[model samples]
Target chain A: MNEHTPTPTEALPGAGNGLPSYLEQSPAVRERFAQLQQRKVILEVRDLQKRYKSLQGETEALRNINFQVHRREFVCVIGPSGCGKSTLIRILAGLEKHTAGDVLLDGQPVTGPGRDRGMVFQGYSLFPWLTVKRNVMFGPLMNGHSRDSAEREARLWLDMVNLGKFADAYPHQLSGGMRQRVAIARALVNEPRILLMDEPFGALDAQTRAKMQRHLLKIWRNLDITVLFITHDLDEAIYLADRILVLKANPGEVQEVIEVPVPRPRSPEQFSTPEFRATKARLEALIHPPEAQGEEEAEGEDALPEKIIRFTNVGDNVE
Target chain B: MNIRILLTYLSRPSRYRGAVFTLGAFLLPVLLWCAVSYVPFIWHPMVKVENPGGVDYFTPGMLVDRSEFQDQMKEMRQAGKPLPVGVRANPIYLPAPHEVARALYTAFTTAPEQRDAPWLHQSLWHSIQVIFWGFVLSSVVGVPLGVLCGTYVTLSRLSEPFVEFFRYLPAPAFGALAVAVLGIYDGPKIAIIFIGTFFQQVLVIANTTRKLDTTILEAARTLGTRGWRLITHVVVPGILPDLYRDQRILLGWAWTYLIVAELIGTSSGITWFITQQARYQHFENVYAAIIIIGVIGFGSDLLFERIGRRLFPWDRTQERKSA
Candidate 1:
């Protein structure tokens, strides 16, 4: 085995440091990788916990959670539906409170709703009374931007989503997908560095969800910002994430971190490859861990040698 | 003529929607009234006579030929008056329908006494004033309180039972309460109209607040829209369609209460005038007041509907579905 320094890019694999396994080309590139790895400490969650007690009995939503998100990384918190995924997102979004533990963002704990992180819910919560331009301009206007500049920013964002033509239209006039586009543009126009999306594509139809997924990837990759997305979809976890964090049911904890090894500008075709399958299989193993049967894991790890052989033979730049 | 208007109406597309109800209910009675009064096509015997003690019957007011009476002769001597020359049957009500209609029109258009005296100098003007006062007070008081009570759970919970209790109370009973509190003056009467509609307006506003789509509130919160600004930009707009609907309905209730308010005393208002004239046995004035109430209520409703549709085209689909 050999050692290698991490790269500045998160999704892309490291590809340098051939000199004595410790020396890189320049001090600057090494520093860049270190800064990318360095904790800008955008958000730090420490021993977070929430429990719900009812006549039916006490049910824990989260228990002793810990994580740190650095600047400009797409951190996806994926889990099953009732696995406290929504509860965790709601706490982060400042809609709900945890029974215990601290959530620190930007060196300060989140006390209430603020514009530091713009959120988009699964429901396209566009104000029906407002046009797209106004809806997008809402945050900027509230943050004390002049109406003219706010509208200009709104137009720019709408154009980014290819929805400039519908800026004058009301939300009800738009389809679900189009409305979601407006919501994205609205959230983006505020210029928040951290975008919190709580299953924002959940309400969309499957076809529209795929389209939105691609659009989100393009937009997200282009913007130098971090996204904390919560979703129950496993395929989505594989598709749009740099590194995926899975949460199990009852009390959500960071169970696994699965890095998607696909190249940038990820296409739907790349997902059918053996590398993608291998990564997905590892995630499935973590999620549904073979029901206490240790033999399956022993055989599964042995069978993976053929999978690598199959990958190089069948899936090398085939497209 | 009405005939031409009716013909033009029937020829248009989608005429049946109008024809199936409104025109039939409104104009059919007029048609029947006119047919019986003026359409000279049918004749029927008014009285029959049999031999004495052989089931002989005499209807006292059913004499068909009373042409040779003295008043008829006296009317013949009057310069421009015509004498009765042929058999004439008096209607069952004594006065024919056309005569009553002519009298109704003359009273409304010329003297305007029957319409004017009860309400104001004119029925339309007075109704407008009453409705305007009632509407203004209701909005000024009802809207802000409703917004406050709607948004705050504590305030709404504390006040809801009392508000609900008052909302369902009869408007006329409130009129009695007003009379007792403020005396029999016009102040009490108008106050009654205000009280009658206030509870309903508040209930509507409160309900609109409660029914606000939860998603918008969450979105607004995320957008840094909190406090008064949230109520202004998001909550208020979210509830505007329902508020606008309640505005129209509230005004209608105000109009209803005003008529009852007027009947409190034999001094003023269209109701008072109608009651006084009916005391004098002037049925024509009573009819005129009925017609005026219909005209005023319908006219205000028309204005409300038009303004409602024009300002809020988004609600047009809602209205159409409800219709």
Candidate 2:
């Protein structure tokens, strides 16, 4: 990974790495390294909780959640349905209010929906009435960017998502996959510090989903923006994440935080690699534990072998 | 004019059914009216007269001419005798289709006074003017207030009972009071149309505004849109297509109230012209005026459908089903 670091000529200004170029003199590199050691924490969530009260009764949605996302990190939150994953991302998007907690983005409290965080949803919630170009340019135009510049930015993102020809097309005219690409471009045009996705590919077909996962990873790497993705798909989390936050349901609580040691620029074939399988099996046990039954545990590590086999079987169906 | 070509067009084309159906829909009522008027030709009197005192014995097969029946009735009136009963009425009571068409042509082209007073087109123009102003005023007042009510639940609740209560109170019931407050010329007529449409428009437009997709609005809000900007940029555009449909329906309703409104305190609209012709027993002219109104209303509806389709081509919800 270090060998792939950008050279001095190739280094972008204000790139995610706050460190000065390592191609400089050794002494300068050391000084810059010392300065860069304090990497900026892009988002901080402390003791977040959500509660819903209806006429029938009160239900806790999330309880005592805490996490920090550093700059340029891709963090995926995986859990079962009703595990408050959507609620958590919605709150972070400033689309929902937290019951009690502090969510700080660049140390400023999130009061309501703002331009700092851009979100893409599983439903592909592009404004159907607007053209693809207009939908992508909406954020910039509303925030007072001149029309020309906003459209320019829109075109850039449209090209990035490979939907440049669909600028004038309506959402209904696009396929499900193309619409999701427009959604991604629409959110990215806002140029927010963090991208919040709530099961963004959950509605897509299997092939489209696989392609989108790859597309999203490529975009995420190029943009170098922090992302907090919420998905119930364990395979998706393992495939495209720096760290996976596994949540347990019944008033969702953070069950574990597993760091993937599988190297960067992950390919589709890596799903079968032993390291990937091992990581997935550990997550599977936490989600559906065989140890829950004492009698079943008498076989000693019985859960691990069966879970690995099931994971490999699921993996084989990916393509 | 090309019968063979039309037949070929109808028979050979895949999508000409709608054209054929539209032609039938227009021609059916006229054909029915023509058929009904020929009852005299098909007459074999059903009622037999049993001359009680041997006065001019009457029989069944004798054709009862309508003019002779009218003459007898006139003679009876002059001679102070009670009018005969059990006699079949004249089929002239329902004017034939050609009679109405002739009367329509005369009303527009012949009557000297038609130029100044309530000529067919003049009366129609007056009715359209009243309806247009009334509809515009209602829309001007209704759409924004409805948007406000939709955005704020407090305003919606406050106006809910008032709108609900007034909607059931018939618009015509206020005609006299409207005359008193707004006067006889055009004010009361316009007011009547306004009263008829405004309350319903408020409720409809408000519901439409409220029903805009929440996710789309949320997406807009996340993009730093808020307050008036939110309404202008997202909420307004989001609801425009639906509101256009609602307006089309409400416009038809406004046309329905035109006759009711014009019937009060003014001899200026198509209904007034019909009433004037009815006074002189000119049934043909009355029928002609009614047909004109119907044609105009139908034309207005076609116009609205065209405008709606042009403005919001994305509104495939209703049009696509028929298409």
Candidate 3:
């Protein structure tokens, strides 16, 4: 895994100028590479593990997970249910504690929650008691920003989300999609370096999900900020991410990391493209490996199994 | 005549139908009382015999007071008119509506001979003081403890059983103990109201706090909020609208114990005044005191409902719950 073998599509242009390789670039482009490398690493996860201790027994949620998200890159981690995808995002957000391994942001180990990272949840957890403006300003106020400045910052983000007219509306008064937009503005108002989203669009209708995806992509390009998004939708990952991380469950582990060959500023029509279909097929195959079928055939034959590990969640194992 | 004219004006749907209904409902009980008190008995002629044997009182099938009959006869003789037929008209059990209204007016207007008397205002003020102090104490003690119990599972498990057990034991049962410990003064009265409302407040507030969604708290944490800030910003505000509702209900419960509290120690509250009047068979005064109590309770409830709505404009459930 540490062979440093670059995947075939790793050379795709990311973020700024889409000029070709260093060997082909002029001296000025080569000189710019040094400066790019200076802030290359934004998040580093090494040997990450999480365990839950219950009266019944110990449950290993995630094991030996390792990844690095580079500066200003959009990365998506896609997995089946109970693959510890939520847990990994929570740890990155510093909302949950990991049992072992290290997670660092800008070379500093994450201790607990800090304002450096913003998080968006699938539930769209906006404070129900506050208006849209107040919800957006909550973080800045907590950080001791003056009321006027916080209000100004809140208005700017609300305008960015196209919800400027709803600054005085309570969360319950808004629809689910609109509420999630407010939540996004609330998190972004703090100006965090990285944004962590856990299935942010999973609860939205398909049309709304597509709209939000486009909106997020537009914002991502405009702000040039790093994003670590978690989801179970393969097409969504392919459409939105520069790189996709596939995870397998039952003591969840990283199965593979695939680079999306499609270029940025993605559109909804790209879902039908051959490149998108190819990447999605590869993920589906990895999720449901061929060996799983062989095991099923052996069970039908009533043959002696090589190992016996009875899991209560047999359906989960099959998935 | 004016009331009849006003009623006719209000009875029209285009006019004040609500006013007509309120006035009609208010008069219904008084009309029933008057009919029951005055309509059953009829007047009967009393034949005065010349037998000279104690002027044999010949009253037939009528409840007649002997001295009242003689007084009527004497008044007729002095007027130079023939003695009208003696008849019984009034019953003593239920007072007329006018009599009760007159009693109420006198109670409000006349200064009692006793010093520092508990008239309408004084009696109401006394009860208010006790209820106010008791409710304040209960809120101060119950809210924080309830928040702690709700926030921490260990504290909830440790305290909930005891709270539930004591809440069922009856707050009034502590009346005697309260008098013994705090003496027969304002202390016992306040203690009774506190005991009546405190346990329930704690349990209700804890349940409200516990019902707070964990997702919102996680959202707050990711924003770099922690410690007391988390409690003040997220937990308290999250449960506040619901907690305000709970307090309203608890306040009503507090009112229930006030009469019992006032009865135990000193005769100082409106309930005491009513009970004292009942002992003397002043039914009109007793009824007046009761009406006063009802009006005040209703007025206070309306005020609380208005304030709750204003404080939590963001809470749809609070608005619906109050309505």
Candidate 4:
């Protein structure tokens, strides 16, 4: 892993000084993620589905949720709330059971969780008794690493996430942003082939969330690790994903696949650019599709229907 | 906290020193008692204990010798200047504040051999023995049962009534039952401690189990962790800081039971020693024994706090940093 290098075509020279896109991320950090899509297929989910019985009737959380996460592909699933976006992410992480079909990781059906994958939950699920460093070391230590090796890995990951100074601090001592950073370091310390994040930064403030988004993007580019990120935020999906999967409600299934054509080392300032705005508007309309003139409102939301506002070249909605 | 804000934060800390200041204010009053009672005066020192009608009548004064004044009054002589109205009369009472301090200092520094063996036994070993035995009994029964109450649904349901029932039984009532069944001896003292401490420790273990964070436990099982690993690594650590705090409280509870045990148990303990002294013409010894008991109790609580700090350093840091 240490001997690998990025070719100029894969590098983002737009970053000042014509550096590799991954180098524009945390410098001196090792590339621990698997190679790009060319390496190997690590996880394959076939016809995966999960159903929940509601008071109204049986509600399908997911149906025919099929996707294969190639080695080192950053995939973001963006959808409406009842679209089973989060459930599919949990199933892929082995944190939730699939009612139909099966999940294969590293060529074996995922019977239960293994060290090969790590999950970052939406809420702060940190253990209160552990210091930041010890929390990071939890997975490796539990897997029976020697104390020294665990400490080394813990320190490396904490520094990678810019939390080296907080290793000895308890989770409560940290702000929401800092704690999520620790959670990321903790998840990545085990060097899982795929890191599953379920809206990990959803609780952060807007400014902090933006900072974390960029940090995550850097981490993704540097490590080239496959990420199964689930979020309802369309901008976040457009911002970070190489490809975004959109899901629809009522027997949830992927409705669209939006491939991001932008190069890496992208900045938040680009969000106002013409290309970015068009993509954002398209996603916004899809997630909140507008109703026909006389059609009834979306189920349970009598006030409004799914959004389908049209837009002009300047990115202003025309309808 | 910044140095500039230190004083702002510190003002509140110092305001809470009311307890320390109050204890200091009483020090001189206690010391006065250790002196005036021993010096000769025209009348009894203070608090005359009279056995005149076989039922004792006590008369308190600014300067009275309890036993001698009581003897003189029973013989139809004056005790001293008449005690003021609203003054409480108890033979063990010392009117002078300084005397109590002297008594306290004397009780602590006096050699064990210098005091009669029975007095020493009653003042020290008796209470210590009771508290020790009580803690042993509680741990022996409470912890395992608490674990069962927490981990297993059937055991929890079955044990709930017993735990709740026993927790409400007054310590003094338990002491009376012990006295009736075991008679005055080591058995009654042990029973007193056991009765006082057992229910609390059981609750500690049971509550810790019942409240083990469900999310963490779920995370553990999802990680392929099961059996002891699931219980020890996930469940135990998840509940440890809470358990340690409860353990510290348990140690203090043991000391509290000691005072209750000594007060009622017919065996040798500081409470028993003080009671016996109060009956005799020994007001000084009673005050002295009480001060010693306070010190012992405070010291035991402190010892456990120190032990908790050492064993659970994470909790200490969490407390100090407010994290």
Chain B alone vs. reference chain B, TM-score for every model: 0.70, 0.79, 0.73, 0.66
Prediction 1 global C-alpha lDDT: 0.71
Candidate 2 residue runs with Cα over 4 Å from true position: A1-38, A290-319, B1-15, B39-90, B112-116
Interface RMSD of 1: 5.8
Stronger candidate by TM-score (1 vs 4): 1
Q: B125 in model 4: Cα distance from truth in Å? A: 3.3
Report model 2's interface C-alpha RMSD after superposition on the true interface residues: 5.3
The parts of candidate 4 lying over 4 Å away from their true place are A1-39, A51-64, A80-85, A248-255, A292-319, B1-96, B106-117, B144-162, B165-188, B209-226, B259-266, B281-291, B306-313, B316-323
Tens-digit lDDT string for candidate 4 (A1-319)? 1112445543333334432232332221123222344568877888888987879988888988777778778888888777878788778777678889989988888876766787787887777778999888887788888999999999998998998988887777678998888878877877788988889888988999999999998888789577989888877887888667778887788776655544555788767654456556556656765554244343455556457564546655456
lDDT of 2 by residue, A1-319 (tens): 1112334443332223343321222454345434433668899888899999978698889998888788888899998677889999999989889999899999999999988898888886888788999999999999999999999999999999999988987787788999989988988898999999988898889999999999999999899688999987878998998778888887988877656655567899988765566567666766766556566455645444544335465447765
Error of 2 at B134 (Å): 0.9
lDDT of 3 by residue, A1-319 (tens): 3413445454332312333321233355345444444658999999999999978799999999998888987889999787999999999999889999999999899988888899999996999999999999999999999999999999999999999989988897788899989989988989898999999999999999989999999999899689999999888898898778888888888887766665545898878655666566667766756568577557745567678877677566654
State chain A's TM-score for model 2. Answer: 0.80
- Report the lDDT tens digits of candidate 1 across residue range B57-90: 3223334433334344465556444433333444
What lDDT does the true structure give each of the candidates? 0.71, 0.79, 0.80, 0.69
Q: Write the per-residue lDDT of candidate 2 for residues B24-70, one digit (tens) a residue.
A: 99889877766656554444233223221222333433335555545
TM-score list, all predictions: 0.76, 0.81, 0.76, 0.70
- Evaluate every candidate with DockQ and list the scores: 0.26, 0.31, 0.31, 0.22
Docking class of 3: acceptable
Residue by residue across A269-292, what tens digits does model 1's lDDT show? 867755555556556655656574
